[model samples]
Target: MRAEAQAYADKINAALALLRRFIDWDKALRRLDELNARVEDPTLWDKPREAQE
Candidate 1:
């Protein structure tokens, strides 16, 4: 039935949306980790301009 197909499509769209959100969250976390590592470096303070970024 068309209705059944529409329901499936809706579910697929929702799953894809959630997947995109999860991917975005994962990327943000990775970026934060990279920044944290940079902060932990003693030389980071040496480059104050770059560290401010």
Candidate 2:
């Protein structure tokens, strides 16, 4: 019984870790989208360094 409980706990912990990674990935995608939108602006070249980023 104790082993079963430990197994369940391990699975839950693994799932939580995966969820955190997914959230970070989603945030990164959103940031990329924002940067891409900025690149579409004609004046983006005004700050070439920022645009290149």
lDDT winner = 1
Clashing pairs in 1: none
Which ten residues in a row are the worst by lDDT in model 1?
A: 20-29
| lDDT at residue 52 of model 2 (Cα atoms) | 79
CA error at residue 9 for candidate 2, angstroms = 31
Ten contiguous residues minimizing lDDT sum, candidate 2:
20-29
Which residue segments of model 2 deviate by more than 4 Å?
Answer: 1-23, 49-53
lDDT of each: 0.90, 0.89
User: TM-score: which candidate is best?
Assistant: 1
Local lDDT at 13 for model 1: 96
Across residues 1-53, which tens digit of lDDT does each residue of candidate 1 receive?
99999999999999988988768877878999999899889899898898899
Provide the global lDDT of candidate 1 against the true structure. 0.90
Candidate 2 overall lDDT versus native: 0.89
lDDT of 2 at 19: 86
Off by over 4 Å in 1: 1-23
lDDT of each residue in 1-53, candidate 2, tens digit only: 99999999999999988888768877878999998899789999998897777
